[model samples]
Target: MSTAEDREELLADVGDRIRAERHARGWTQAQLGTRCGLSAKVVAHVENGQTSLPLYYLAELCCGLGVTMSALLSDAWVMPTRQREERALTPRQAHILRVAASTGLPLSQVAARVGTTRQVVAARLSESYRLLGVSHLPQDERRAAAARIAEERGLFDAIESYAA
Candidate 1:
């Protein structure tokens, strides 16, 4: 976002954008939460950018907010710098993450579609945590749950794949 700022500002700017879009649609945080299947508190956090959005959820939120994915990619946003270095993951881990991000499937749906269980998805995300150099993330706290993240951020721009 606007130059001459720190990473926190960048995160807040992204949050503000999400809030702006929500207001534009005349949707309350709760309403948007319902759309995203997240609690309002989570939406508040993402709008604040206090957490690094999992790339998969970021794409979903972009679609749900009626914004392009590129909207979230400007300098306005930054992944937490301490983790997720360039050389952290194996090729397989990276590919799986990419697939999750691009697929627009919520964790459970993603698992189901692949004929697996949510535990499998959780394992993948935990692997992602390691790959990203983060600590192990509990299932609920993991940042990749599409529906949960969308609801929390009032993300109207998620891919809307369920309707298809």
Candidate 2:
């Protein structure tokens, strides 16, 4: 079981992840709120890293995000405990990851977009491979995998910009 602090962090991270995805789809808070049967304020709160609702809200969020409660609750979305040393990658790495995840752009393309070398992009992707235990998949492959688990319902083309 997680401590209260851990739970709070998890809730906050889930909010961030979901809201980011929602925004990527170009959906506004109001639109996501409607999808989740929440008020826009509530959606804003959640996206602002404030998710303090009952389990039903979790269900609604999952439905709205086209994911499952399990995936949302999974460590990937859940915030890390304080004791956990894990951290997000550096900006360059993060940008590389987002592009790779969103478009699965080739390493050369990612390097071009980020004004970096292919080797740098390759190194960053290698880290993801160590963490995910496989080479990262193209957007399509990820969608296929998600579909097997009833996940990856669609694209979030809203908030995505080249992480300049």
The whole-model lDDT of each prediction reads: 0.59, 0.63
**Cα-based TM-score, every candidate:** 0.38, 0.42
Model 2 vs. true fold: TM: 0.42
* lDDT, candidate 2, 1-164, per-residue tens: 66988878877777787776676566788888898898889878776666576778778877986778787666666532223223334445455666666566787997888788999878876764443333456644642332222212122222245352
Give the poorly placed runs of model 2, Cα more than 4 Å off: 76-164
Instruction: Kindly give the stretch of ten consecutive residues in candidate 1 with the minimal lDDT sum.
Output: 78-87
lDDT of 1 at 98: 44
Instruction: TM-score for candidate 1, please give it.
Output: 0.38
Among residues 3 or more apart in sequence or in different chains, the pairs in candidate 2 whose N, CA or C atoms overlap within 3 Å are 23-159, 24-156, 24-157, 24-158, 24-159, 25-156, 25-157, 25-158, 26-158
